[model samples]
Target: MTQFHAYQNRNPASRERYPYLLDIQSDLLGELRTTVVVPLCPADLAENMRLSHLNPSLEIDGRRYVAMTQELAGIERKRLGKTVHDLGSYREQIIASIDFLMSGI
Candidate 1:
């Protein structure tokens, strides 16, 4: 899977946990074992949590969602399904979001 690609959570039980997930795993890791993901949440929820919002907002199947930078994880590749959309155009913002979460600066 490509970095910055967003995928829908197919698991019904865990869908509420992270309705949408962004693939932040490094492409350099060719043949990935696990996909590093950052959860995308509704704009209001993101604002409530004070998490960084994915600039321009991400559109998945015509619906807009903002990335919750602070909520990140790595899940087995097998668990992820098809690509829902890609955030490549917002690369800088996405990277900055991660940096902010990591360094708080």
Candidate 2:
């Protein structure tokens, strides 16, 4: 597992709106039992209501998803399941969104 990699959202209750959880925790912290993640929501449902930079548009599984940075959380690594997609290409945006959430820049 690595930063910017997305995994299937294990909780079925929220899966329709957020189908994936993008791991943002650093590789150096891989040993931790809990992994930090941000839910990736359907663009049409989340984008318009989000702040700029705080919610980046991402492509996953041939669809567009909005990174719900404000929903950042840490869950058990085992709950993340297998990696469904690699979001490494959106590294800068992902980092920036987190930065914006922490520092407003």
- What's the lDDT for all of these models? 0.75, 0.91
Which candidate gets the maximum lDDT versus the true structure? 2
Tens digits of per-residue lDDT for model 2 on 1-105? 788899999898988998899999999999999989999999989956787689999998789999999999989999886798999999999999999999998
Output the worst ten-in-a-row residue range by lDDT, candidate 1: 47-56
Worst 10 residues of 2 by lDDT: 44-53
RMSD of 2: 1.0
* TM-scores for all predictions: 0.82, 0.95
- Once model 1 is optimally superposed onto the true structure by TM-score, how far is the C-alpha of residue 54 displaced, in angstroms? 8.3
RMSD of each: 2.3, 1.0
Q: How high is the lDDT of residue 23 in model 2?
A: 95
Off by over 4 Å in 2: none
Residues 38-65 of candidate 1: C-alpha lDDT, one tens digit per residue: 8777665555555443332566776667
